[model samples]
Target: MVIDDSSAMRLILGRIMRSLGFDVVEAPNGAEAIARLQSGAMPEIALVDWNMPVMDGLAFVNAVRREEKWRQITLMMVTTESEQSQIVRALAAGAHEYVIKPFTPDAIADKLALLGVLAY
Candidate 1:
């Protein structure tokens, strides 16, 4: 799943996910993403954006980590928040990986591979 406020970003990430042999689902914000999850959309991995309205990525990670059913979903933050402290906070909140914005598709794939969500 790709959770981002920008439709363009969603499109870009969705295309990348599809290219990597995965089905893609997208939500414009964390709240809508949660709704999709509650409605039985069980994505193996969720690429989330940090600055979205109606529930930021950190809050989404916290919410997902609190639920046993959502434990298997790998959360990756794809955002412009590049501070070392921000990355640490996201990881501490159960995000499996973090990718800053302006990243290449290869960078994303490599991170997914490192997280074991994608095969090299």
Candidate 2:
């Protein structure tokens, strides 16, 4: 699932996921993503933006971690926040991986590979 306030961002991420053989879902914010999940829509990997309206990515990560059933869902931070401390905070808060903005397809592929979500 791609959670971001920007429609262009969602489309970009969705296209990338599709190229990687993933079926993409979208939410404009953490609230919508949570609502979708509660409604029985589960995506294996969620690409979350750190800053957004109606709830941010950190809140979403915390919320997802609060539920036992959502433990298998890997949360990846994909945003423009390049602060080391910010990255550490997200990593500390149950984020499986982090990818900064302006990232290339290969960058995402490498991280996914490390996460065991991508083979080769």
Q: Residues 10-111, candidate 1, lDDT per residue (tens digit)?
A: 999999999999999999999999999999999999999999999999999999999999999999999999999999999999999999999999999999
Q: In order, how many clashes per candidate?
A: 0, 0
For each candidate in turn, the TM-score is 0.98, 0.98
Candidate 2 global Cα RMSD: 0.6
TM-score of 2: 0.98
Whole-model lDDT values for every prediction: 0.97, 0.94
Error of 2 at 4 (Å): 0.8
| Candidate closest to the true structure, highest TM-score | 1
Residue-level lDDT for 93 in candidate 1: 96
lDDT per residue for candidate 2 within 22-58, as digits (tens), equals 9999999999999999999988899999999989999
Task: In angstroms, give how far residue 38 of model 1 lies from its true place.
Answer: 0.4
In candidate 1, which residue pairs get closer than 3 Å at backbone N, Cα or C atoms, i.e. clash? none
Candidate 1 regions off by >4 Å?
none
